[model samples]
Target: MRHIVIRNLGPLAEADVFLNKINIIVGPQSAGKSCLLKTACFCNWVEKRIQLSQDTDAFKENGVFENKFLEFHKLYGYVKEDSYIEYENDSMKFSYSWKTKVFDFSWKEEGRWNYVCPKISYIPAERNIVAAIPNWFEVSMKNDNIRNFMKDWQEARSVMTEDMPILNLGVSYRYDKSNNMDKVTVGDGVVLDFTNTSSGLQSLIPLLVHLEFLYTKRFNTEQSKNILRIEEEGTLISIIWNYAKNKSHGEFNIEKVYSNFTEMKRTEVFLEEPEQNLFPPTQGVLAYRLMDWARGEKGGFLFVATHSPYMVTSFLEKDNENDISLFFNKESKDGRYVVSTATEKEVQELYDYSIDLFHNLESLG
Candidate 1:
């Protein structure tokens, strides 16, 4: 299990969360739902950087850490003088404070550090723009989240060999590599340009494409090991050399490190607004699909920040055997947001809110 504690960060006053395999955060706009998820993403990135460098002083300069982790996510502005964060998992522990400007990290055990480097992907809420304009990354966009998503979107499109179905939607998305175009195939043989598709699909396609691509690429143990071996050749060499030196000193078992590095990789995805431009039924289906991906034989972690009641309800109402946590964020009396586990009463509140919205719309008719 993983745990996170945040305080005085952005719109969030306090958030203490014990993360599960599948975690969902739901709240009104500006209630710190996305902030919580982004904070987690930043913490994970920090962990990865420290592991790769094998140095706690990897981010010796606070400016370097802020720019790479906080500024990249446009979260620097949210940091107050007293902002503080701490994250811990099976492998390592990380803590940082804005007031003190101190970053503290430690491995769980003496020598048995979990060497699995996660393959992480962040899907932004603005992903529809990536689908609408596949070349958007070429434009001058300062948002790192969307830009990163576009890169993955392009790669996913290039690798897709056949049409991929849209859940609960009677359409399949196809990419024409030769023509460098995207098309949507309807029920018969009719195909239309992707840009001419519905808004719902325009948003859903990018999310699904990247989700499927990353999962397939990361969950395949043999394939992922080979790819990582090639890409992290230098890092692996350094790690092995250090392990061998430590073994000669009778420090620890080198074989255990190699075993962990080779076999323990997991995929982590931070998805924003997964119910974007989707209908209620389609949102439910999407939730189910996402849950399945996290609960697959090859385990993965999914963290979603969403506003849709349908999306939250779908996940909450599922017959889940795996660990799943639903967090609800709301404004407290002190004008700060607090996040806590969703209770049955909170779930009913969401249902009532949805019904009130529908009734308000009915009055116009």
Candidate 2:
């Protein structure tokens, strides 16, 4: 398990999140749940970059460090020196000071926790927008999360085989590129046009394929190349992940691997509102499937920010209570944001609230 603590970061006045194999964050809108997840993502991204640089001089000599810090500052807006982030495990500590931009990383007995950086990803609430994309053309978006979503969507579409796990979804949609335009087929019918698919599926495909992309990466293999090249668009974290996986395997010719690559990444994904547009049963399926992926062969970390009680209670009901950590984000009477562990009874009513709405997704959701 790992621990993350944040002070004076965005709407998260003071927040602490513990990460187990599977971690969940639930709260009302504008309660700073997304803020906490994003902040943790940024810090985890940076730490892995540091680890990458430490393990390989090519990464350091190439100026990836300065580039990453400047990029993070521009993208995340590290407000002040007063705000800080601290991450730790039993044997190691990773700390950063936003005001001064200093990092301190230490391990009690060297080489104990020099683990590969988990592949990091986030599924934004706006994922459905990618399905709106036309067959041959790409959509333009300024938001980082949205851009990453589309990039992952395009990559997943380009590589997926007919037997991909996403095909198991109740209504699996496959991207057909041989058609006049990029087309999608749901079941045996004419769902080739994404506009014709249900909003629920449009939202689910990216999440499905993205996980497929990540879980397939085998960092332990003897591959000729390490990194998986993606469009230059999207988060630096993805870039860092590509670089780290490459470095972990042994040094490689950057220019040659730059254009070609193999494998999935070993990293974490921060999922926002995974329950979006999903029915209760599918919501439960998505929740359990993500956990299975997190603890699967690839084995990266998983963090979820949600409003659905089904996403919460389903895991509890699945008898994974001991392996997961749950946090409830809420604002107090005085406007201070507080995060507390959720109890089973507390989330039961919340699950009931969400389950009731599933039958009425047309009017609800």
Quick one: best TM-score, which candidate? Answer: 1
lDDT of 2 by residue, 1-365 (tens): 67888776555667776777778887777777877787667666665554443333333344343345334333355344587778776546676666655566676444333354455677778777767655423455454666766776676666554534343563544556576333456566545566667787778877787777667733443334334322221233355456557564555444333222223346588888998888887888877788787787676678889888778777666644467777776665667566766556554544566556433322321
lDDT tens digits by residue: candidate 1, 1-365: 88999999888999999998899987778989888998888888787766655667756576566567675687768888998889998778888888888887778764335566677788888888965775665788775777787877887877665988888678898789888888889777789888888888889988888778777753552443355555564676567777577555666555666555645466788999999888888899999999888777544789999888688778877745747787877677888888887655654555557645422321211
> Which stretches of candidate 1 lie above 4 Å from their native place?
110-112, 217-256, 259-264, 343-365
Best by lDDT: 1
Error of 1 at 364 (Å): 31
The global C-alpha lDDT for each of the candidates, from Candidate 1 onward, is 0.76, 0.62
**lDDT, residue 109, model 1:** 64
lDDT of 1 at 322: 46
